[model samples]
Target: METITENQKVRAAKKLKKMFGHVDLRDTSLICPIRDVMAVASDKWSILIVLYLGYFPVLRFNELKKKVYGISNKVLSERLKHLEGDGYLKRTMYPEVPVRVEYKLTDFGHSYLQKLIELTEWAETHKNCVISNRTSYHGS
Candidate 1:
């Protein structure tokens, strides 16, 4: 496995510091908030779920699980709660015999999704280069 060099780590730290405004590298408490926010949005399944929900207004838990492959029920539930807590998603439950639960993006979530779309476009453009770099770095 390739180890990140000190210079690269320093540069990455600088970039993150600039992006996040204030981040104390030494303080665990200082880091948790940023980490939690990232954890809520940064997972592959979460990103895919957001993208899928962007195309549709709402989806049931099972439906979302179907659309997002490789996610377990526990993980999906946790991620959904995290997203909802972060104001990126809203969950509604219907009072009925069978009971229906639905998840949808909030207005805030849609705005964030727009930004994600731009980032996705940028990533798509650079994907080949990124893959080549990764392969080369991993000695594949």
Candidate 2:
């Protein structure tokens, strides 16, 4: 892993401050946009859903359920609705004997997926180290 220099750390901190400096915890009416967005976008299921859609381009509800294993139908339905509401993905319904529905990422979703790819790659690269650290912490 590349080490972060003191200057880099300071710059990162400054950027975060710029983004969040206006946040007032005492004001209940003010919403933290970043937190609200991340609450849906950064969850494990949403990440998998986005990644899978990135790979497959489009998928049906059942297809997404299969790809994102262990997610309950209710949760999957809820996440899909949230993702669609956030403008990350789109849902299309077809008129037929039985309705056909498909899900696909929008341009915004693709942009977010690019960012997620970087995070996913970092996680993949460091997973073993993280597990080792977790074991060490627990063993101690």
Best candidate according to lDDT: 2
Tell me the number of clashing residue pairs for each predicted model. Answer: 0, 0
In model 2, the runs with Cα more than 4 Å from the true position are 25-31
Off by over 4 Å in 1: 1-24, 138-140
lDDT (tens digit, per residue) of candidate 2 on 24-125: 867645666766999999999999999999999989999999999999999999999999999999999999768989999999999999999999899998
Q: How much is the lDDT of residue 37 in candidate 2?
A: 91
Q: Give TM-scores for every candidate, taking all chains together and pairing residue i with residue i.
A: 0.77, 0.91
- Give the range where candidate 1 is weakest over 10 consecutive residues by summed lDDT: 19-28
TM-score of 1: 0.77
lDDT of 1 at 74: 98
lDDT string for model 1 (51-134, tens) is 988988999999999999989999999989988988999999999879999999999899879988998998988898899999
